[model samples]
Target: MDFKVFTIIATIVNFLILLAFLKHFLFEKVSNAIDERSNNIKNTIDKTNSDREEAKNLKIQVEENLANSKLQGKNIVEDYKGRAEKLFQDIKKEASNEAELIMERAKKDVEREKEKAEEELKKKVVDLAVILSSKALEKDINEKEHRRLIEDFITKVGM
Candidate 1:
């Protein structure tokens, strides 16, 4: 091989010019493309993290709502039970009052019947006494007239 110093110098100058051209055009575009890709990846990662945080917050809210719902359900059930108990007491009191009214009415009925029976017995006794008196006196008068005379005499003495 034949070595040429001038040719070597020319080749070195050509290589430096090619490196400068690549740096200005191809290398700059490649670096810009790489930076754009890195930015896109970072944005995607930030969005993913935000979505994950939102999901976690939603889960926590759901759990809290479920707990509140259970508490409200228990309160509702307790309220119903209290109302039922009050209703039961009111019904029992009403029944008791009704029973008392019935007993009082029954007692009044019994008293009325007793008084009626006593009135009937007094009338019968009066009738028997008037007949006996008429028979003992040997009066030929009707029993009714004799009883009327006795009644008039008693009334005059009493007044």
Candidate 2:
């Protein structure tokens, strides 16, 4: 071959060796670094999504607890109302019983007073009759006639 052609071939071989070295040393390391950065970004995104889901679950749990607490409060109020009604009924019954007892006692006291007054009246009537008979007998004395007059007075009085 010619001298010029030999120089051109050597220069082409040198350019190919330089391209191979650049591909092996610089391009591979830069590509690996880029891949590692992409993987880190993917991992961070997954972790953020997991955290958001956990927050959502916690909110739902809190709402459920609030609803349960409200139900419990309502139940407590109903229970108290029932208890109060029962207590009021018991008090009313007791008052009614006491009033009945007081009325019965008053009636018994009135009956006893009536019996006492009747006995006193009967005794007074007997005494007055004796006095009247004694005064009349001093003027006209017959024992049978006196007894008959007293018996007639007693029959007219009826007691």
Candidate 3:
């Protein structure tokens, strides 16, 4: 290389000026754009993580609510079963009481019928005794014969 002092100095100065211009205009714009893109990517990642965490919390809350609903359903079913059992018992007790009343009424009716039959029999016996006494008086027997007749009548009534 033939060393030219003025040309070499001028080329070096020109190259430094070009580098300064590229740094100020092109490199600075490219770096700013890259920094903006990096910031946007970081913000997107953070938002995605936050959203995922929120979804997890929501899932947990929903599961707890479902468990509570199941417990409530079981309690409701148990309450209905208890009510049904109580109703069945009440019906059975009522039926038993009705049967007892019917039996008691039937017993009273039987007693009334028996007493009525006894009254009718006693009335018939009294009428027959009165008729027999009148016929014996109409026969006009002697005292000893009358006594014998009365004794025979008494024995027939006893039989």
If scored against the real structure, what TM-score would every candidate get? 0.79, 0.61, 0.72
TM-score of 1: 0.79
lDDT by residue for model 1 (20-111), tens: 99999999999999999999999999999999999999999999999999999999999999999999999999999999999999999999
Of the two candidates 2 and 3, the one with more favorable lDDT, higher being better, is 3
lDDT of 2: 0.82
Ranking by TM-score: 1, 3, 2
Ranking of all candidate structures by their lDDT, best first:
1, 3, 2
Candidate 2: lDDT of 49?
Answer: 94
lDDT of 3 by residue, 27-110 (tens): 999999999999999999999999999999999999999999999999999999999999999999999999999999999999
Weakest lDDT window of 10 consecutive positions for candidate 2: 136-145
Best candidate, lDDT? 1
What does candidate 2's lDDT look like per residue over 15-73, in tens digits?
98998998899889989999999999999999899998999999999999999999999
- The 10 consecutive residues of candidate 1 with the worst lDDT sum are 150-159
| Alpha carbon deviation, residue 153, candidate 2 (Å) | 9.4
Where in model 1 is the C-alpha error above 4 Å?
140-159
**Cα error, candidate 1, residue 123 (Å):** 1.8
Off by over 4 Å in 2: 1-40, 136-159
